[model samples]
Target: MGESDATIVSMILAGDPRGLNRFLSRYGHMLAEYIRALTGDDNDLFSAVYEDVLVDILKQLRVLAGTHETPEIKKLSGKGELLRPIFESAARTVRRRFPDLLKASEEPKASPLPVDDLAAFANSIDHVDFKTLLEGLAGPERELLVLRYRLGFDYAEISNIIREARVQLEERLVNARHHFRARLFASQQKAMV
Candidate 1:
C-alpha cells in the first residue's frame, strides 16, 4: 500500500529528503491542475506558480505538519486538507505576480444576452449541457465553478484561494451560474429549431 499522508509528513519533518520527492510525486498533478485552472492555462504563469508552491511547501514544512494550533496551519489530517493552505498561499503569490490577470478575472466582459432574458433562461440543465456551458464561461468563472463543485471547496476556501471577499465570491459564482444556464438554454433552443 502507498504511504499515508501522515507518514509522508513525518518523513519530511524527520529530514528525509526522499519524503519531499514523494510529496511532489503524489500531489504534483493536482498542483498543476489547480494552477492551470486559476491562471487560465497560461503555461508560463503555471510554471512560476508551481515553483513558488514548491518553495513555500518546503519552507513551511514544519508548520504544515501542525507544529502550532493557531494561524495558518490548523490541522494536518490528510493530503487533501494539507494542500488547502498551500494552494491558497500559492494563489496569493500568483495574484501578486500577475495583478493584471487578477483584474481581468475579476471583471469579465458582460454576456451578450439581456439580463431579463438571461435570467429567464437560467434553469436546471443536463450534465452534458452543463459541461459545455461551463466550458463556454470566461476563465475565472470556469475556475470558480470547478473549485466549488469539482474540487468540493467551500466558499471560505475559495475566497482565500481567489483572494476575494466571501460576498464578492458568492456574487461572482452566482453570475457564473446564471451565464452557464443562459448559454445552455440558448444552445438547447438552437438545437431544437
Candidate 2:
C-alpha cells in the first residue's frame, strides 16, 4: 500500500504524462465527486470547483516534491489519506460560500442563509456536556460527530476525510449518533432527579 501511494504521488510529481494521466483517470471522478459534494452539488459549477480542488491538491503535492515530507506522504494509507487535509481545507473555505454561491448560481432564486447561522452552528457544539458525551465514543465515532456536527461536513466529505467507505461511514454515524443521544438523555434524566 505504501509503495502504491508513493508510486502514485511519484507519478504525479515526476513530470510524466503517463503517470499523471493514469492517476487522473483513476481518481478524477472520485475527486470531482468529493468537490461536488463540498461545493453544493451545483452541476454548472462542478467543473470549475473540481479544477480548483485538483490544482490545490497538486500544488500542495508539488510543495512536498523536494521536502522531507515526500516519503512521509508515501507512507500514508491511500488516496483518501493523502486528500484528507486538502478536503478539510476546502470544507472550511469553499463550503462556507455555498449559500451565497448557490443562490447566485440559481439567479438568486435560492434563499440565503441567515448571517449568524454558521456562528450559531459552531457555538452549538461549544459545550462541556457535548464534549463529555463525545469522550464516551470511540475514535471514529467521536471524529464523525465533530466532523458532521461541528465542522458541518456531510457524510460524503466525512467518508473521504476519515478514509472510510461511504456505506460504513453511514452505519457508524447512525450508531454513534444514536448512542450519543441516549447518553445525553440519560444525563438529563440524572440532572432532573
Q: Write the residue-wise lDDT of candidate 2 on 67-132 in tens digits.
A: 435666557545545555655544443444433432221111222334545464345533437656
Residues forming the 10-long window of minimal summed lDDT in candidate 2: 102-111
lDDT of model number 1: 0.66
What C-alpha lDDT, on a 0 to 100 scale, does residue 108 get in candidate 2?
13
lDDT of 2 at 50: 66
Candidate 2 residue 78 C-alpha distance from true site, Å: 5.2
The reply for model 2, stretches above 4 Å from the true place, is 1-3, 38-43, 67-69, 77-80, 92-193
lDDT of 2 at 130: 64
lDDT (0 to 1) per candidate: 0.66, 0.57
RMSD of 1: 5.5
Candidate closest to the true structure, highest lDDT? 1
lDDT of 2: 0.57
Over 75-113, each residue of candidate 1 has an lDDT whose tens digit, in order, gives: 444566566766676666666665544443333344354
Q: RMSD to the native, candidate 2? A: 15.0
